[model samples]
Each structure stands twice: as C-alpha cells, then as structure tokens.
Target: MTGVVRLATRGSELALWQTKWVVSLLPVPTEIVTVETEGDRDQERSLTEIGGQGVFVKEIQRHVLDRRATIAVHSAKDLPSTSVDGLVVGAWLPRANPFDAIVGCTLSELAPRARVGTSSLRRSAQLRALRPDVDIVSLRGNIRTRLTKGKGLDAIFVAAAALERLEIQPPVVEILDARVMMPQVGQGVVAVECRADDREMIQLLSALSDRETELSVLAERSFLRTFGTGCSLPIGAFAEMQDGTIMLSAMVAAPDGTRVLRGSLRGEDPEQLGGLLASDLVERGALALLSASEGKG
Candidate 1:
C-alpha cells in the first residue's frame, strides 16, 4: 500500500483498457505488468482445446502468486468458478451490460445456412437452439480481430460490454436479450485478484468493490461452481437483485443445442439461490447434457 502497485494483466487492447480502468480507481500509483496467457498465445485453437475456463487467467494469476505483481486484473468471465488456493478476488468492479450483441446482421434477418462466428460454446449452443439452420463458425481473437475476421460472415457475437468499454460501435448491433441468451457467469464484471494472505493489498482492493455487482457475480459464480470447476460445457448464468431479492437464471445445453435446461430461482442469499437453481437443473437432467458435451470434447 506504499510503493507503486504492480497490476498483472493480458496484453490485449480490452485487457489493457480494463486494467487502466482499475488503475484510475486505485489510491496508489500503479504499474501494469502485461503477461501473455495461453489463450492469447494460441488464438487459432478453441478455448476448450487449449484448457477452457482458466486459459486467459492462470498466467495472470501466476504473476501475482509469484509476487511479480500486487494484483491481477481480469475480465471476470475469464475466471473459472473454482478459487485459486493462493489468490483471491479482492474486488468486483461495477457490472456493465451483461448481454451479448450480434454484429453485421440481426438474428432474425440472417438467411438460412448463414455463417455466424463466435468462439464461446455458450453462445454457440444458444444460437443453434434459436437458429439451427445457421452455421456456428469457430472464431477467436480480441474484439477488433473478431470484427475484422467476421467480414464475410453473416454475423458474429461479441459481448456488449467489450464494445462499450472500447467505445467501438458497428453499423449494425443487435443486443440479445438475457432470455434469448443468458450471459456467462461474471460476464460484465471486472475482478481484481491478489495474494490471499496479503492483508494490505486485499484491504486496498476491497475498498473498490461494488456491493451490488459483487453479490450478483457471486451468485452466478456459485451457480457455475455447483457444476464443477473448469467446466467447458455450454452453460450460462446471470443474476440480478430485484426488490432486495436475488433473482438467478441459468441454462445448460447440449453442444448441438438439441436440449436445453433452463431455470430460475430467487433468494436473499446469493450462494444459496445459485445452488438451488443449479440443483434444480441437474434434477431435470442437466447432467446428461453435460455428459454428452464431455463425450464430444
């Protein structure tokens, strides 16, 4: 809490922007230490093939664990549901637009067999469930790279928060409803991780935590955690506080989108609400869909 705090983050444009935002809020001066994660190194391979949930965050966390950085900044969606033993998320920035946006064309306007690009299995499964005729191409990279690669495709899915953070707006942007596409856990939140035993650092970062955002993200993450850590299947969860109660919605689907188990639950305790919702889905055969997805993997 005295000298400059080193922040570990990815080198991508969005990652830098997110880290810079954290720096702006910190009381102490900061130094950003950009680390190349496996996800950033191998953009060609699907995330599942490259190690799924933690692909973008493990290396960044390592920087903090090694004391190379005081904290690790990450797009919360990149983090796996399981907590790292030595690292802890100290702060949750205020949530942004927790919705997916379709660029280039509206969902309804796409022709049959139109190619749509996205790397997220959650998005792919939901899109397939909605438009089985369209092709879900494997597309990866930063926001700009994905936009550029989607030139010939009918459309591409991007997180609405990413575009908003970078202030880039395409000519055609259709924000998908949560009902149409439940967002990934922690989708629009920024998480700051630090050494769990570093009391000073944890205190400094915790001061910046947003209560409402923290609760919602906690609920969503709890829902995903019930499924297990490092789960790469097509699953999504979103939580919001309504009238002092937490309302959580989630979905589990087959990779081909043949079957999707959707459910919602409400409770005051975020963790309990998430667990109840996930348990309900499992009882309804969500585990079968997860097993089928694992078989494909």
Candidate 2:
C-alpha cells in the first residue's frame, strides 16, 4: 500500500484491458506487469493437448508467488478450478455478459455442412449437438487474430463479454442464451490474486470485490472443482442469485457431442449448491462421459 502495486497479467489485449480497469478502481498507484504464458506461446495446438487447466495462469501466478509482482490479474475462467497452494483470489469484479456470441452468421441461418469456428471444446460440443450437419472447425488465437481467421468460416463463437470489453462489434452478432449454451465457470469475471500471507494486499483488493459476482463465481467454481483438476472434457456451469438463493445449472458432454448430461440446483450456500449439482450429474453418468472422452484422447 506504500508503493506502486505491481499487477501481473497476460499480455493479451483483452487481459490488459481488464487489468487497466482494475487499476482505475484502486486507490493507490499501480504498475502493470505483462507475462506471456504457455497458452500464449502455442497457438497451433489445442488447449487440451498443450495442458488445459493452468497453461494460461501458472507463469503469471509464479510472478506473484516469487514477489516479482504484488498481485496477479486473470480472466477468471482461465484459472484452474483448484487454487494454487500459495495463492488466493482476493477479489471478483462484477460479472459481465456471461454468454457465447456468434459472429458472421446466426445459428439458424447457417446452411448444412457450414463451418463453425471455435477454440473451446465446450462451444464445439454444444454446437455439434445443436447442429450435427455443420462442421466444428478448430480455431485459435487472440480476438483480432480469430476474427481475421474466421473470415472464411460460416461463423465463429466467442464470449459476449470479450466483445464488449474490447468494444468490437461484428456486422452480425448473435448472443446465445444460457439455456441453449451454458457458459464456462467464472466466465465474464475478473479475478485478482495475491499471496495468502499478504494480509494488507488482500484487504486492499477485497474493497473492490462485488458480493454478487463473488458468490456466483464461488458456486460455479465449486461445481468445476468437483470434476477434479485434470478434467479436459467439455464442461459448462453458470450460477446466479435468484431471490435469496443461488441457482446453478451445469452440463457435461463428450468431446464429440454424443452424450450430454445436464443438471441444476438451488440453495442458500453457493458451494453446497454447486457440489450437489455436480454430484447429481455424476450420479446420472457424467463420469462415464468423461471416461469415454479421456479414452478417446
């Protein structure tokens, strides 16, 4: 609190935008430390092949743990469900539009055998389930790069929040409803992490946290944590407050979109609601779907 707070973050355009927004809200001086992560190094490979869970965050987290940075900023969805041993999320920014958006063509407008581009297995699986006739192309890169690559494709799926944050508006954009496509856990949220022992830093960051967003992310992440650390299958969970209770909806699917399991639950405790929903889905054959997908991998 005495000196400038060094905020560690990825060098991506979206990442920087989110971090700067955080800086704007802080009452003290700040410095942005951009770190290129594993996921940034390999745009040619799929996330699962390049190590899915922590590829984008480990190095950025290392900066904080090693004292090179005071805090780490992350697009919450990029983080693994399990927390790092020495790190803790000090704050959760208010949620944005937590829904997938399609650019170039509407889902209903695409012709048979049309190609849909996406880098997320969750998006691919759901798209495949919805339109078996269309092709799910493997697309990768930053938002600008992806938009350039999607020129030849019939459509490309991206996060609605990403488009909003970057202020990029495609000629044709369609927001997919959560009921049609559940979002990834922690989607549309920005998380700030610091060392668990940094009591002063934690207290400073906590002042910027939004209670509703924290509870929603807590429930969604609890559901994801129930799936374990090595889960690479197509999984999606979304949580929101309804009256005084937390309502969570989740889905687990095969990579190929053959079998999908969906469940939901409401409770006053976020973690309990998430865990219960996950358990219900697992009991209804979510594990078998995970196994089949892993075996295929």
Candidate 3:
C-alpha cells in the first residue's frame, strides 16, 4: 500500500506555488501541510537576526523529522550550508531565472537618491555597486506586501522567479546580467527533502531531480561554505556548467559596497573548482571585505 507523501511548506503564496509545481510532476499523491516559520512569524525583523538561513526551512524540516510530513519543500537558496543528519535532499528542481530584477513604477525613471527596498544584503550591495546614488532600504514581507508597500521606495529588487510565479507584471524590471550581479547559492531552485530512510519517497523524488541544477548548486554551496559567510554578508556566487566544465563566479564586499573582491575559477570537478575559486579570492584579500561585510574584525 503506497502511503500519501505529506509535503510540508510555509503557506506563503510563492512557497505553496513552488510545492504544487513539484507535486504536479510526481506520480504519487501529495498532501500539503503548512507550517508557520520563524520568518513568517516575525516579518518585521531582518532574516539575520531572526535566525539566518534556516528560519524558513527549520520548521518544514521539523515536520518531516517528526513524521508529521513525509517530505519538505523549500527554496534551495534558504537551505542551511550543512546537511541535516536525519534528512537528505531528494531532488533539486530545474532552476529558474536566478537573477535580481530592479523594478520601478516606470521604465523611464530617474530620481537621484531614490529609495530602493530589498531584504537581501547581496542585492543591496550589488545595486550600490551599480548605482551608488540610490538610497537602499530594508523591506521584508511576501511579494504582495512588498509591492503594496512599495509606496515609499522609488523601486525595489526581487527575484525574477518570484514575480513570474505570482503572475504579476512588475511595472518595470531591469534584469541584471549574471556576470554583473551574481545570484545567491542555490537561488531559483527548489529542494525536496525526505528522511534518509524513506527509500520509496526518495526514489520518487530522485526522478524529478535535475542533474545540472544539482551540480551547479553543489558548487555554489561549496564556495559559500568555504568562505564561511552568513546570509547577512555581502556575498554572492553563481556557478554553471559550460561544455562539460564548471565555471564559478563569486564576490565579497564591504557592506557599503565601497570595496569588493571578485573572481572566478573553472575545472572539471564542480566542488573542487568552487573551492579553488573561493581560495583564490581569499588569497587575494576577499577575507578582509568579507569580514567587514559580516561586521567582524
């Protein structure tokens, strides 16, 4: 008798949308169980203070561990760097745009010192690098909230995938090139997690895993782990496979974006290639800016 797979996720519109998309591709029946996460509870606080990368994922993971849910679905970018002992990532779905978009009220817009709202330091820093005159401010909430409250800021920055999922046409979206604005590790990918011993569920999800996204995210995660930067750090990485070789680009910056260190490395081995790229950046003084970015000495 095949049991139903209970997938745990936050109840946010985007989160549920992602889960439904994954479930659509699977053969087995799925039951969605919404778990309110720390991030959802404290929408006013910065993610770093509320619990960092795992704030949204921990609750879903807990549901799986407690046997209340057979699997957990999460935005791959929000996952913790270290793998949990009791669970395994059963799949990494094919990625989306994986780029930041600058959205404004009009395509032809110009307001010096215009306020720009964003929750991520990575996006803020990259925007500063490109347009230092804009005033960057912290804005956190679901897509609907942010867009509704977009009154104060002249514009905002958000993931392209999120906007597309919502089916809302951003008034104007300036998509930054990946070479200029590297994405966070695992961005635009969805991860399905299950208890390591759930062989049946694992086999089902394994079929949905995208090998290219898996390898690329693996490399990006390795790079981030080696650097030891948290979500608050002004760091970004993006990796891709090019003609059977892995190429990784990464950056570390002072929070203010006044100083930044960027570099890349390539190799046949994605993990090793990422480490080499991170090490090269470290050797060339990336640690200095990374430390400052993290508010460390």
Candidate 4:
C-alpha cells in the first residue's frame, strides 16, 4: 500500500527466489534490491572459513540497519543465533520441508566407504550416524556446484526445499526424515527482519506470519542459542507440530561425526520446549561434543 517498499536480499538465485516469494505475499508495491554479499562472491571458500552462514545475511541486514531498505529477507537457518543490533525478526513464514535429502544417489546404493559431499556439520554428523562407514568430504559452493561435483560422491545431502525451488531433478536417493537426522535450527523457514521498534513494518509482516511455523522454529532456534554453538557447529535440530503439540529433536556431533548425542522434548511453548530439548541433549553429552569441535561458531 505504500510507495515502492524496498526489499533487501542477497543475490543468490535461491535467495532471490525466496525474496520474490515473500514479496508476492505483500500487498504493497515492491522493489527488489539485490546486494552481492561476501558469501555470494567467494565461491572458493567454505562458509565456516568466511563467517559461517552469516556471510549471506550480514550485508542485507546492513541495508535494513542503515535505513536503505524497509526489511531484509533471509533463510532463517543462515542467520546467527544472536539477533542483529537494531533489528528483529518481525515475521516467520510457513516452513517448507525441513528434512535433509540424499541426492545424486540413494543412501543404500552408494558403494561401501563411498565419498559423500557436504559441508554442513549437521549433515555430516547425521550421515555418519546413519552410516558410519561412508566417507564425508567438504564439498563447498552452491547447490548446483555440489550436485555437479557429486559425480564421484555416492551421494550428497541438501535441503529438499532448495532442490525443489531450483527445479533440480536429481534422482533423489532418499529424503532423510527428521527423526533420523534432525535438521538445522530454522531450516526450511524464511524470516522477515525489520527495525525492532518499527511498528508499521512489524504490523505489515505480521500478516504474513504463520504462528505454528513461528513457534516451531522459535523452539528450534532457542535450543541452538542455548547450546551457544553458532552456525558452524555440527548441530542439527527440528521441531514439528503434531496433534497440537510441538515435538523437537536435536543432535550435536564431532566434525568427524564419530561422537554424537541426541534427545527430544515436547511441549506447546516454542522457547520453553526448545530449552528443555537442549537441556536433554546437554545432559546426554552435547556440551562435551561442542567443546571438542573446532570452528564451532
């Protein structure tokens, strides 16, 4: 309803797609303002090597903080556990698939001791949990690159929503259910960020917010924040709404995925439930795993 509301977004194809999708839900005229963040330009480095997944969101957040844009859109998983100064999550849209998909090859058909490409500690840890025999390697770059380089890989794990959004049709070997491998906190969700005190913007975004998705991810993210492991940690967490109850599962593992601890908690309140789930995991030795793992942001 306002004169061209500027929306800040990263230049990645996936990020653009997410931004455009969110924009479509808005009633006001929108001007998509793309910014090339460091993560987009540096394809040679791993996300952990740069600034973790935050590399993809920091620049766009800058636009919001600087008042260049009314809001910044991001894949919630890419954000840091800590909230940005001067900004807050105004809205959380409905989540997409939060499960990790085994692509290029099915998990069963992959050769013994087969090389699997993935840079996510979460994925690596989960894969190791399922099949400790497989080799895990750091395969960086975008989804397209990983899939292309997956020629030698028995398989690669990626977010199912991403593959679907990109219209990728790799014979997905298997879509690992969250019960097997909990997803990263905030995975499969998009968050709208705006100035914390901007009542107008907050109200606009609230219209798009889905309460169930918000509560579920809130619990998941709270669990992550409680653990104090940022994006670089080999941490996987996911929460689902079942019968009006939120069931959360989470796990933490060593970089090699040899040491892992997992647990679950269920409740109605996202933050409280997530905290309980995290405590259960910590009691099961998650803290020790985080302590041993290097580069756990």
Candidate 5:
C-alpha cells in the first residue's frame, strides 16, 4: 500500500471489472495497464484453436515480468493449470455465482436441432448431453457481443458471474445449476498475481485474500494441475465448503458428450482431496475421455 501498484489486465469489460474489484480492496493507488491479448484480438476462433486457457494471460503477465506492472488481474478460469516460474497467484477475491447462464432463451424452449452458440467444450458437451437434438455451434466474443451476436442461433451460453458482475440480466436468462452442468474450475473467481520476488506487494495483496476462497481454489485447480489439462478439454470441477470440510465434485466427458466420467471426494486437505477425486476419475476411465480430446481441457 506504500507504493503505486500498477495492475495489468485484458482490455475487456469483464476483465476491467475484475481488475477494479481487486483495486478497490487494496489500500494502494492503482494504475490500470490494459493489454490487448491474442484471445481478445481473435474473437471468432475457438479458444482451443488459439491457445486454450493461456491465451488471455500470457501477454498480461509479460507486463508484470518486464516491470511494466506490479500485478496481473484475471478471471481465474482463464488461467492455465500449470504454475509459471517467477510468478504466483498471491490472492483471490471472494467468489461469486459459479455457474453458467443461458442467455436469450430457456433450455427447453429452443426447438429440436435449434442452433445454440457457445465456445466452451465443457458447455457444448453438457448441452449436447442435455439435448442431443440441438445443434451446438462455436460462438465467441465479449459478454455484450455474445448476448447480441447472431449465427442463426437460438441462444448463447455465458458465465453467470459475468452477467451478474456487469449487472446484465437478459430477459430470458436461465441460471443453470451446477448439478446439470458442472462449472469450470475456478469459475466466478478473481485472481491477483505478482512476481515471486515482490514480497511487499504480495504481503499487501494477501490482506485482501479470503481464506475459504483460497482453499476452494487450491482444491479445484489442484485437480486441474494433477490431471495436467487446461481449457478446451471437456472437464469441470466445483469445490465448496460443507460444514467445515471441503467437498469436491469433478467430471470428465467425451468431446461429443457420448460418455461422461464423474466422481466426488471430501476431506480436510484441499489439494489431497482434489488429487484423490482425480484418481477416482482416472480409475473410471477419465484418462480415456481426456486422451480422446485434443488441446488443453
């Protein structure tokens, strides 16, 4: 809080919202350094085609690495599962609604073979499982654009956190439950990253950290890292606190939703619990499901 903290972030509305949220909680003056990422530049292509979860984060982290900024703010879900050398996620803000929302129409309202838009493999696969008759098409862009975009589609799927953060409640939004379509790992969370050597800044940022949120993140992303995958794979995990222990549920599915392997595990150790859940999944042929898919999942 003694020095000016420059925050590097993607130049998107949702990204900015997450950045400012981090800034507001800190005691230091913040300078927003907006970076136009490869992901931002190419909205029409699927995320897997570009670079999966790392597409939006690498450039922003470059600013921090090169001393252009002090920290990087990102949607937690956009981050890669692997750790980056010389950098660490110092803190996480309190999580928000961690689920997907169907915008512009209800799930059952769309006609058979009705065109639906989404870019997430997890969402697309789950949607296909829910309604095999509907056509799932690739659609990309910001929250505003996706909500208004046309691909002869009946509706678009988006994160519930984005809409709620942007104060957008489209007339036909249907909040999909985690039971139906499990959420992406780290969804609805905001992460703040800093250089490994920046002790002062890391300590300051730690003050804003919520321990429960941090534990949930540890469990969720532990599964991702142990599984060794990122976005683009049809995988989903959601971790939450039940009473005092951490309860984790995860799913791995075929790209076409023909087969889904899922399991849950609960314990005190977040990391161990996630790892155990993943082991259970692998025993249930999750490795086959993961191997069948290409790119990061």
Candidate 6:
C-alpha cells in the first residue's frame, strides 16, 4: 500500500481516463503501463470473428500475471464472466450510469429505415427490437472515431457511463432506459485485477472496493456464468440494490431480434438471485434463442 502500484491498461482515451481515475483514488504513487490487445489492432473485423471482447482483455491480464505490472484496470463489463485462473477482481469501484446512450438522435426520434451504427450485437438486437425498419451497420472505433463515423449514420449506440466519464457533448445525447434496453453485466463498474498470490496488492486494492457495487456485479456475473457466455452471446444482465435487497434482471435475444426473453428476481443472496433468474429465462426457452445465435456465428 505504501509503494508505487504499476497499472496496466488498454491505450485508449476512455481507458486512460478510467485508469487515471483509479490512480487518483489511490494513496501511493501509480504508474500506467499501456498495453494494446488484439481488439485494438483488428478494428475492421467483427468481435465474434476475432475471439470476442476477451481479445481486449487477455494481454492486459498477462502483464499482471507476468509481474510486468502489479495490477490491471478494466471496464467491468468488458471482462469475461468467469474469473481467470490466478487472477482475481480485487476491487470494484462504485457504479456509474448503467444505461446505454444514443448519439445524434433518440431511439424514437429516428426516422424509419434510418441508418444506425453499432459494434455490439446486444445493442443491435435491442435496437432492432425497437425499430425493425431501421438499417444497422457495423461501426467500430474509439469514442472520437465513433462520433466521426456517426456523422454518416443517423445515430449510434454508446455507453452513457463512457460519455459521462469523458464529459463529452454530442449533438444529440439521449439516455436509453434500462427497462427498454437491458444493460450488459457489470456495466458502469470499474474492476482491478491482481495476482491471487499478491496479498499486498490485493489488500491495497480491496481498500478501494465498494461493497454495493461488488455485490451488484457479483449477481450479474453469476447470471452470465450460469448462461456460460461472455459478450459473444446476445445476452444482457443487470443488478442493483433496492432497500437492502438485490434485484437482478437479465435478457436473452436473437441476433436478428426475432425473440427476446426478459426476467428478474429479488433476493438477499446475490448468487442465488442471479442463478434463479437465469433459470427462469432458461425455462422460458432462452436456451433455444441462444443456441440459434451461436449456430449463426
């Protein structure tokens, strides 16, 4: 806790902002070690074709495991549901806005057959559910590039938390309600991963962890783990605390947006609540929808 903590992160403006925010919260000196993962280099290919979001995370995690860095900071939602071997999410900062943001126009404001851009399957599926008449195009890049790309399209889907953290102002900023577009698991949370054997780093990072955020994400991740997937699957899970109780909500949708299953459960035990809700979805034929999407990919 007294010495400098070496933090590894992706080399993006949003990533740097998140890491710097973490650094500001720490007591000791912190140095950032920028690491570019596969996702950064292969900007044109689809995430599913290139091994999912894990492509953006693996290299960063390696730095911590190899001792090049003492810790790795990441957007919680980008992380895989299952914990990596020898690494643990030592801390989760307080949550941010979990709803997705639309730039250039609101969902309802868009004209029928209007072109919308997004790189995420979840976002596309939800948007299609709302506007089957619109055209969805593949859009991939950083915030600046996406904004630039949006100039060609009628609208774009982005994380509200990312825009809020960067204090960006778009021509049209509309925050989508989570009820209409379920958020990905661990959205709006920042998590730091440390080697399991490094008790010192664990203790140091643990001090910054917020219990409420940790529990909320725990339940969300539990749902994801039960479903056995990462971002590759068109599924979304979100959890929040309400009056000392946990409410877990999740959705499973076809990539084409033909079918969508939504469910929620309230309880004290985070893991149980997550599993129970997941089961509700499975019993309601979510498995079939997930299977069809997997086959298409």
Give the clashing pairs for model 3: none
Q: Per-residue error at 223 for model 2, in Å?
A: 0.7
TM-score of 2: 0.98
Better of 1 and 4 by lDDT: 1
> What does candidate 3's lDDT look like per residue over 142-234, in tens digits?
988998777677988778789887887875778777766778888888999999998888888888999888889888888888876557677
Off by over 4 Å in 6: 1-3, 295-297
TM-score of each: 0.98, 0.98, 0.95, 0.94, 0.96, 0.97
| lDDT of every predicted structure (CA atoms) | 0.90, 0.89, 0.83, 0.83, 0.87, 0.89
The Cα error of candidate 5 at residue 70, in Å, is 0.2
Local error of candidate 6 at residue 162 (angstroms): 0.8
- Clash pairs detected, candidate 6: none
Residue-wise C-alpha lDDT for candidate 6, range 217-280, written one tens digit per residue: 9999999888788877789988889999998888999889988899888998888888889999
What is the TM-score of candidate 5?
0.96
Q: Residue-wise lDDT of candidate 2 within 1-297, one digit each (tens)?
A: 699899999999999999999999999999999999999999988888888888899999999999999999999999999899999999999999999899999988988999989878888888878887888888999998999999999999999999999999999999998888878899899999999999999999899999999999999999999987432568999988999788889999877887778888888888888889999998999888777666332
lDDT of 6: 0.89
Question: What are the per-residue Cα lDDT tens digits for candidate 1 across 38-130?
Answer: 999998888888888799999999988899999999999989998999999999999999999999999889889999999888888898898
**How well does candidate 3 score on lDDT at residue 67?**
99
- Return the TM-score for candidate 3, rounded to 2 decimals: 0.95
Residue 67 C-alpha lDDT in model 5: 93
For model 4, what is the error of residue 200's alpha carbon versus the real structure, in angstroms, after optimal superposition? Answer: 1.0
Task: Give the CA lDDT, 0 to 100, for residue 116 in model 4.
Answer: 92
